[model samples]
Structure formats: structure tokens, C-alpha cells
Target: MTDRAKGWLVDLRPDERWDDEACCGDLPAEETRMADRLCDSASAATYIRARSVIRRGLAGLLGEPPAEIRLASEVGGRPVLPDHPDWYVSWSRSKSLLLLAARYGEPVGVDLEVIRPISPAAGVLRTVYPRTAELGAVDQSETFFTAWTLLEAAVKATGRGLARGARDVWLYRPSGESRCALGGIRNAGEVPWSGRTEQFAVPGSSTRVMTAVVTKGFTDPIHVDAWQLPDRPPSPVTAAAPRRLLRKEVSA
Candidate 1:
């Protein structure tokens, strides 16, 4: 499936148990070391599985074996290819879903989230964001997820982790456009990102899971090409109706 982007390739898979023997061998020593550092066995396993999926997905694009794809990280931890500097990758997880996105020549960051009702105390982060403030208390989950995804994609694209980015990044609508976008990144480093955030949906579950991405090189009409992956039944993610889209503008 695709949206307005020329194409940001994404794979949405369940963060479930995997064949450790089969996939784990494909991961690098770096990932193994990172996994060893984690105290929670479940969290460590998830990290390993996420990396393995990333390796296979990225290796397909590079026409190499998954085990041969060497990975590195930026100063703030977004994964990258040392040999292929032009390629970029980022991922996010929401409940059972894992979102993996890859882009060539342009830096990209992505986020996925499960929609859930918000409470006042749980929404303290919402108060910092001007966009979420526009949403009513009774009906803000969808819009809140959209706003948060935009904020995260911007920070991830900028190579700054949320610890720092959350304090600085501001979600904004570019004047006349109805869709929310990312702005207010001061330390974007060497890459000058357009900071335009785009949202997509995975239809299933009691509610719905949403994903968004942003390309860091300041491009227009950013687009997404996504796959639901295996292990789940896919359904329609209609963006043509605003009322159905959290009154959010769908960028086709």
C-alpha cells in the first residue's frame, strides 16, 4: 500500500516470538551485546527479533544476505549502514505490532502507536504540544496518536533521541495545510529535514494502530509504501473521509 510519498518502505509485523536459532544468527555481534545488556529477558528478546527483521528486510533491498548487512548507529542511536551511507532506517512498536521503515538516499524516521483513551494525568505530555490542545478531552485518542507520532518522527529523523527532542520539537500545521507536520528542530545536525510528518493506519485489533514517517532532506509530497507483512489479516485503511480519519487530513 502507498501514500503520497515517492515511497518509504515499511514492514508491519507482530513482535512475537521468533526462531532464535534461524534469525539470531543473522544479527551482528553489536546487537547481541546490546541484548546481553538488557535486564528484562522479554525486552531483550524483542530487541533481537526487531533487529533480525530489520536485517532481512534491509538485506532484500541491498541484494545481500541478511547476515552480511553490517549495521551502525548515529550519535543518538538511529540505525544506519556503514558501507551504504545513503540508506536510513527506523522502527517503532505498539502492543503486538512492530513497524520497520527503510528509505534510500533520504534520512527517515517512523513511529507506530495503538490508539487508547487518554486520561488527564496520562496526558501531561499532551499539554506541552499545541496540536493536542486543539482536540477535545472526550475525543482525543486518534488525534493524540497522530500528534505524538509526528513529534516522534521529527525527533527520530533529526537523529536526536526523545530525551532531548521531546523538550524541543514542536508539532505544527504548515499554515494552510490541514495535516499535522513536524517543526521546531534546532539541532538537526548535518541533515536538513523538511520535517513533514505523514500518518498511515493498520486496520485490525479492537481499535487501530497508526504509523507515520518523515524524510529528513526537506522533500515535498513525502510518500509511504507499506506491507502488512505475514501473521495477520489485513483490512482497509481508508483516508478519503476526514470524519473517519480523526478529522485529520489524509495525505494520499
Candidate 2:
């Protein structure tokens, strides 16, 4: 399938974030309640900004004003453009970064995470991959987050969410430059979603974010914009194999 994917990385910091009075007005009623239920103030903020961006961005690409777009979530809370069933939309946030992804004619899921050591990693490792021994033998934090993001993107692409796809999906990368493949439930069948992991820097900060996108039948080099700012023009996209998660690369 010829899937066209475009992604934008928006900063969620108070000074650099992209929500305005109009954005607030365009937010659906369910969105406000979802924000009200968020315990973390920061998360509540991210949720508002992310939802607003998704609506606005999708509207831009669809040639309509934000209010005209009817964004809805499927059974697993994965957002979709119900009016245009051919379009797929997804977003993810971590700390102060938000990624908004939209693709035409294919299912898509995107996720972002600020990479660091996980304190409760051991317990989580056993919980997600209980049936596997090889996953436990590798670097727990590294492998876990790698697989974790893949699982998230995969589920989102399939509209399955973690409740249905978590334990079934596993990560495997044969080489540093090789494409990462996701395995199915108990490694039995081919999972519908395929994943790509990218590491990018926040323009002025030292913080690096790990981002992943999964699309149904997507091929090499899906268009990814790691540093698209609200005021600045988008940087050029270079779809290359992902670098190892170490903090050495300076460019996307």
C-alpha cells in the first residue's frame, strides 16, 4: 500500500507549546473531562495541547477549519477521522514533547518517550513479556522501552490498545541498521503493524526523545519531522534506519 505519513514534533513547554484561545474552543466536551480526570497537572496540560494539535493539524491537511473536523476515538481510544475513514491519526507525548502523526490510506500509530533508566523496570519486564526468556536476558531497560514503544505504536495502528496487544507483541532487531520487526501473540502469526524507532534532539536542549511510528504495510523511510516548530518551517525529513539509543547522534 502507498501510505503517505507526515509527523510533527511540537514542544509542550509553557513558553513553546502550541495551544491558543481558538484551540481551547475547538476542544470537544469529552476532551475536557479527560483532562479533568488526569491526576498529573503536567499530563493534563499535555493532553490538552496534544488533542488541540491533532485537531488543528488534521484540519490543515484536510482543508477544513479545526471546528469542522469531527475527530473521534475507536474502541481503544485511538483517534480517527470518522468522516474520512481513509485517514489515520495518532499522537504521543513524553515530558514536554508531543508528536502528531497523520497518514492517508493506512492505519498509523506514533509514540514518544524520554529515554532514561526505569526504576521499576524489573517488575515491568516480567509483567509484559512473561512467556519469553530471551527478552529477560538482554538489557532490561533498553529492551523494555524498545519493545514498549513498539507495542504501543502497534496497538494504536491496529486500534487494539495494550489490553489486547501488549503481551502478544515482542521486539527484535537483527542488527543496528536492520529494520526492527514486531512478533505476534506467542510469536505465532504476523502482527499487522510494523514499527520504526527514531532518536531526535530538542533544538536548544540536550534532551533527546525516542519516538516510534507503526503503519500497516508501511515501507522504508516514512516522512518524519523530528523538529517541526510552531513558528519555524519544518526541517527536511531524512528517512534512515534508526541509530542505537545512545546519545551520540546530533542530527535526525
TM-scores for candidates 1 onward, in order: 0.64, 0.72
lDDT of 2 by residue, 214-237 (tens): 876645335776565422213222
- Off by more than 4 A, model 1: 1-20, 30-45, 121-123, 126-139, 167-170, 173-179, 183-204, 217-252
Model 2 accuracy (lDDT, Cα):
0.63
Model 2, 153: alpha-carbon shift in Å? Answer: 0.8
Number of clashing pairs, model 1? 5
Query: In order, what lDDT does every prediction score?
Result: 0.58, 0.63
Question: What value of lDDT does candidate 1 attain over all alpha carbons?
Answer: 0.58
Off by over 4 Å in 2: 1-3, 16-19, 25-45, 120-122, 175-192, 219-221, 230-252
lDDT of 2 at 36: 62
List model 1 lDDT by residue over 99-149, tens digit each: 777777677778877666666622654555543554344245545566677
